[model samples]
Target chain A: MKRNSTWKTVHRYGVYNKSTGAKVSLTGGFGYDYTDGSTATRGFISPNGAWFDNPTVAFTAAAPTKAVTAQNEAKTPYTLSWAPGKLSKKVAVVEALKASGPNFFTAWVDNGGEVDVRITNNGGTYEAKYYTMGTSTQIANPFTASVGDDSSSPIIASEITSNKWLGWMHSPEKRTQIYWAGGASISFYQETNMSADATLLGKTNGAGNTGYTTLYAVENRAIADATKFPVEAATWVASTTDAYEYGRVNASADVRFYFTALNPPAGKLARTLYLDVNPAGPDAGDKAIMFNFSANERSKEYTSFAATPVTATLNKTGSNLRISNGHTSPWSLGIQRWQVLLTPHFTSGALVRLGGTTQ
Target chain B: MIALKADGTVYAMSEPMVLNYVHAASKDMNENKEIVFVKEDGNNHNPVPALCTAPTASRHYPGGTTDVVVCSVEPSDFGTKTYKLRYNGKWVNGLPDMEGRNSENDKNGFRVTMVNPKAGTVVTHTVGGVTTNYVLKPLAVAEAFLPESNAALCNDINFTTVAQFGWSMSDLPSATMIPTAIPNLGQSAGTSKFEVLGRQWRRISLSIRAFS
Candidate 1:
């Protein structure tokens, strides 16, 4: 193995809006680590107070405390997947997101999600899978022949399903590229510790199928095709049907996608989408709602007008939001605001995480 | 067809037409045409009355008691016998007289009486073209009837022989009713032709009544 390089700030950035003239960060933005692991553990920590103030970026040698916030458990599982390229430019494009946190990556995991990365060669088309681990184990189908109520499971096929895997990748495709795959694997992150010496399930020159490398991680979440947003580099139009704007998000990145209502700001619109935890309702389910905010009185409407419902399986893919009880629209209300941070990374087509490649 | 001499003897036609039934025996009267009736409303009612004679007014006589022979067909011709009343009042066209058939007891008929008016009261009653003034006291009473009473009430004038002042007319007593009595009611039976000196006596009271 070769010696790794040290981490340093190459290009730093700050996001601002022309309308409000306020700088902002995404919800649940992940941290990054340069080749050596030190940079990933620290630097650019959000401030200690509320959202209205700047997300204070502190640089200290102190590593990130890995203890989970409510956000971590909520995004119980994450998944990462991608397509590999032969040359470094193809890999460079996919790896740039991983190296530097962009406006697209989403997650608070200091290391852009401990990616469970894997590689695969579908006949000649090489594809990769990317994923992460979650605190929860795979739940049962909760169904019976007579009555099955598992339609909302992120995984199909009594496991996790993906499209093209439907006809075994053989469909005269013209935009009907809709299907599901990926299920709970018995051995995902089955190994307990990452500090000790460990080995992946398969090697590069293994049996007849050495072409695929299966990786794993704990507390991971799969960027379902429905929620994955790959940015301009190897850009992909996000497959999310509910995005308020036409934008993109990377699979390795875990952050709540901030957008306006279906009717975006008229000329140059800038609105904030909040994540408020609904008090345990009649069902005692205190789910957080993603609300769009305007600097004016428009924020109060998120609970009633212009709120979208999300599936439980796809709850917070590290990309969900939380609106503090007091944060508000118009960027006022020091606490009631859309305070989210999303850090995006490219998945060089790897099958890693809880529900990834069969290998 | 009758005679109404100034002596008060009213004589009618032998066939029974009235002479001057009202003005007869009335002082302040004249030989004026006795206006018996004056028809009104163009009076085209019924068999038009006769041209000269006017019998008294009558009704149905609808009872079995002694009643006056107030007949209708005695030639009461209103158009031929009407004597225009001297309309001396300041009223325009004069106050109207009730029609002949309704005037038997009507107040709008010709009236005459005497009064001495108080100061400020008007006593001018036109006779011919002569006008006179006799002021009198004010009272709620209506205009008087006789110009003589009006004149007396106003100026305290007296009624006497007309030949003297034209203010009045009456008679003194005859020889029998004289205060001397003529000893035996004869003009020559009086005693003191040398010592008796006296004034003339007058009638009892004045008769100031309506005129013809």
Candidate 2:
């Protein structure tokens, strides 16, 4: 087998030799060729006798295969790998693979079989491959590792607690009951704001004639405090000679009493005020005074001393009654003493106790 | 009546008048004559008669007569009920007398025997040839439920976390049945249900940075 010469250069035109009966020789820039049995000099020829101006051939290397470490189910660090080869200056790209979708690269490193990758987000499958530089191969299968928000399969949940402060009071009527009675004397004095010691007097005769009783001076002046009386009380003239004087009398004397005030304790409910008079005569002619007092004063009297075997009855009118002086003769009856009773009424109920720590 | 202030102070007044009841002066038959009731329209003054039945005029008799007009009433009538006594063709401006004879017989005027009267219990009173009947109805008491303070955290949750939990007063927990429990929500086993004025509350919050 004969080996063919390599061509150094090629010329566009062919040359002919006239001496030595057409000697054939190959030059640097020309070639000897035979065309239709005619000797000629032409452009350089390839070893395979093909034209030299043909396109150049190219050599390409195969893509490297990749293998990745199992992705962590938690937020931990993991590894990625590729098939070993001549260490190229190219870098390997690591990326995370979305479920059945495209891969997103998080980092890149020099070409190596195995590279460490860190996952900060939720964890899942990952992909890695060698990066191509300045060519169609520049893009590589991204290496990625799965990351998770938390370590548990299902996210852990927390519970919440709360507290509140309260200020509470029971219904006022349900707390406690207050019994109260208040009344004013109907004497000429008509004093509504009398001292605590003011005495109300009534008289009775042997015949049980209920007549007007005398309103003596407000006794116990020494014990009376100025603060107890209203401003109007100071203007009244106190009787000098007969500190105690008799009121005008009639066949049937009727005296009236009125309630001045009714105040119950906090958390207590007031029922009613009961009024009755105590006479020196037999317990034959006393009547009940029925009235209600709240924050205001009342002008009505519920009971009267008209005709009697005076049995105490609940007086709805809240009126004043007369006591029989019980005197057969006008001069026969002397000074008699009588007292009025004022009692408060209340309903029995539960009491509300306050002031304590609660949760 | 006692007035309670927000600062926890109480002020009381004596001789407080009964709400809605008014007094009118009347002519007296004799000096110091006991006038049971009076009616005045700012123009005319009339005295209510002694206790006699319906269709009969009130008669004025000597003092110390046992004859008296009797009527029954309830405790709830104190502030809400209106009474008009009649004498001599005029209506009086006072409630009826409900005085018992003595302590042993305590059933006086306006007896409050039952907690409340049955529906349609009519109370009738005849005076001055006119009879008026009053029907007793159930009393309506005022009630309310209030929050006293902000809910505090009972657990590790902080205020911010508690806020994040979307806690609301409408979602308050079921209160324990006790005297201290609020009405409608919780009340003691045997006690009557009282109205709830207010209550204390609690809440919880949390801040999470690490998992454990």
Candidate 3:
């Protein structure tokens, strides 16, 4: 199972009312991922010098059973089926989410969060799939059934069965594109590891299937059908002045994609998506580090934020940041080594080491 | 010049310099170069910016409690900086100088942004037509009923009241009974002069009644 390396999170503590079983005296502390590896393996030694395994808890699956069903579809042992047209298929999937029960997923529906119905030929022929954006947990249906066998007329399937439900996270093996609906909401990213010796999307002939090359497609609203489909290189828009922005992360190039979507749903605040891409390829002697910062404190987001480098002068205030280090797979920690005191509070002899892809 | 790369790495744009601070008071070398001293030597130094300061002890409010800790960081060539409170583990940043005239702006001092996640709320306070937004964490109802001594455990926006009065449950002589003998109760009794004191006492009583 993939380890939980959440960059930003909150830990709430409170007293419970014994009679009503209700929470009282609720208090919480905000926490960031400070360590590199799973505390289980890295462990920890207390001030007394007694070593013990880091405290860990099972990943409580988010409620509204459908959310779990949808996430399961994106993992291993599941292949995403494609649909001919995504319009009607999206409606059926939304209906299933609405009926699934009241959870953050349903809250998104109540807020009129836009649902994008994807009907691309993602590794195979199947029906349309739609995923809700801006929810605590994003849910999508990569159904198993295929329809419109005949090319003359396409059939729009309306049935969204439990077996067909899958999560929005796409399988990387298929070299599929993951769309991040950019807005005020926090971006939930499942760790995607690109191995050094592993085969990438590009082919040996110096040509790459655009499907495999373009890994992340970020936009707040729907894109033109012409630009989104046929999985071609020309379809990915790269203009800085455009309403949307995307990155084709070549291994050697350090590219920054700046996106600000002005037109957001009412009550939704549009934000700037700053993605500093460093792909794990042959560059840097086989290691890469990717940095993504999109939200600010007002949004109460977890993923990434503006990163200020540790300076020798100590002029700028060091922010509480979550930096994912390592260019290799399982992107653990301790890739680059340098020590800088984060604040004046540090003792004269104390040194805090910062890890990074480059320094 | 030390420049920050896109991936948050510090690189030498010019000749590399040691990241150390020389304290002016004692002329001692601070190896880490992070802590800013009130006085620094003539050499170029990085000092922590003192944006705002909060009380170390909890500041009791009408309905809640809050404590503040002051931290400093040296200003960098980079624009605005962000910080996380070690006490609460919450991220805070300085607000932009919207008026471009007030001391609360980046030029004078920074305005700290606070967020209360549970309420998903932001409260903007405007004074003299200058507006600043701050998130107010929800104060539990139980806090409004705490004995004044124990009430200083909650958190809220900073405010000061000119007049303050507090009477604890311990102030009363008996917890279960009301005194029967004219209740001497620290006040003059049964005279025209006492009538004036009684009126003043009644007003204090009403204010306390409205508070609870």
Candidate 4:
């Protein structure tokens, strides 16, 4: 019951970044210090699964378990997982479950006495409990088949973006190449930001010609070891691939995809939301949020946003901003709710303030 | 693994090489998960003359027993899959096949034969595992596996909680058998037994969860 000692003073603007202002060198390790860089509660290491700033193993300590209710239908899954820090907040979620790839998680079920019972406070002051049904264990991945890289063909990077954003991952070592797999040509990195020849990186791929694409970041180390009971999705790519050559298996084909953006520019806070704030509505932050998005708007863009008031702002001159959706789709923008998961507890307020660095 | 033929004979896994079998990729998973070995029309079935990468092997598909499943066995696109049978002191790739990993409806795919005379196959893949060598009896020639063989429709595999209880979105249910991965097939009634001597082949199919 001790308070987290690593927590710095609450910020009016946003969370702290490894570098100053909203800039990442993009050279060495991308100077990005996590909100919970290295501490017990917010730290990433755990006896179970080390999830310092790991998103898959992160948990939220909100009541009514508000975090669970925040789930909205997604083109991409939540890609979550269990990351215990010797101690965690969410009661029932013993092992962190992934929201992507082969790691599976359905709604509640009955235990029939054979399973274990877990309890939590469903936002109510008192704690709540849940009885998991049918025993469960993690399984192997779906992309066991070796897929030859699009060899003998160099595709225009722009052609890769003209379609539905199929999920992607990056393999470590020298084998650095983008792939468009699935039924059709799945799009990868939208605006290849870097000039050509700037080799890319992402989750490393495995041995079966299936190395990691650039769409995901590994939150832990042990998630890749293939020997375990088969239940770890730490290495899954959370983007959808529209181009399935075997053709799609229908809605039931166990195919799921994901897409992620670079961590918000250090010192800069970005929020992805399902709902937008009405320009003429009651003070912003009054409306509740749903999903997350990672789009950057520009040139004459008009968008309204609402942020909740903590201590209450004094002068409110349109706390919301207007930005262009540009060429991106805000279909399920809810990244704001996603924070650097602190093994046991995931905190949302970890982001830095808008336009301004943490004072 | 050793494949049990219908005639109650134990077909040794003579070879142990993975074969790549691929089907059309579609949107609806339940309907597209089928793999059948059918003929164009009245053709009995045009069997592959020899089923091994190394032409040195004198036998294959009709050589003895083969286990086939509907999956991404194409070694070119994906990687070479393992299709082996048990024989002699060491487990060989001549016997039958393994289970199909694709979980859905391959009610209309086909099963072919493959072999690898090469010793060091792709890592993590081979023809067969362990073998007993005891030949039981011979199996009937199932003309149903040839490309020209009648496209025998497989209509019994089922999934989903709404379709059948217990399988939630994350259910990892799997099946392993000589004929079908799902018990919803014709052999579940225990009609088919083990067989050793056979011109055609037998198959073992298993369906596991690819993702949640």
Q: In terms of lDDT, which candidate is strongest? A: 3
Scored by TM-score, the top model is 3
The C-alpha stretches of model 4 lying farther than 4 A from their native spots are: A1-61, A64-359, B1-212
* Cα lDDT tens digits for candidate 2, A1-359: 00121111111111112222221222111122222223232222211111212111101012111111112254222111111101001111121222443211112333322221221123342222222311123223222222221213211111001101100111111111111110110001111211111121111121322221112111222111222111111111221211112121232122321111112212211111111134332132322121111000122112121221223321212112121222122111111111222211111121111111000
List the global CA lDDT of all models: 0.22, 0.21, 0.23, 0.21
CAPRI level of candidate 3: incorrect
TM-score of each: 0.13, 0.14, 0.18, 0.16
Q: Model 2 reaches what TM-score against the true structure?
A: 0.14
Q: What are the root-mean-square deviations of the candidates from the true structure over C-alphas?
A: 63.0, 59.5, 28.6, 31.1
Q: What is candidate 3's lDDT per residue for B1-212, written digit by digit as tens?
A: 01122332221111111111111211111111222112111111122122324343443222323332333322222122221111111212121111111112122322221111233223233334554443323333111111222344434324453222244556667845774545464665558767777787899899999999
Better of 2 and 3 by DockQ: 3
lDDT of 3 by residue, A109-218 (tens): 22224332333332232233344431122233222244322223221223223222322333221123232221111123222211110122112222222112212222
Cα lDDT tens digits for candidate 1, A1-359: 00121111111222223334443323322222222233222211121121211222211112211221122334322111101100010111111111211111111122322322222333332222333321122222322322222323222243332232221211111111212122211111111111100122112243322322222221223222322221111111122432222222235232222122212222211121211113111112211211222111223222111223222221111222222233323323122222221112213333323211100
Give model 3's TM-score for chain A to 2 decimal places: 0.17
Span of 10 residues, lowest total lDDT, candidate 4 chain B: B43-52
Candidate 4 lDDT by residue in tens digits, B106-171: 334333321212111212221234321211111221222212223343333355445465455455
Task: Give the TM-score (vs. native) of candidate 4.
Answer: 0.16
The two-chain DockQ for each candidate, comma-separated, is: 0.00, 0.00, 0.01, 0.01
Model 2 ranges with Cα > 4 A deviation: A1-190, A194-359, B1-13, B21-94, B99-212
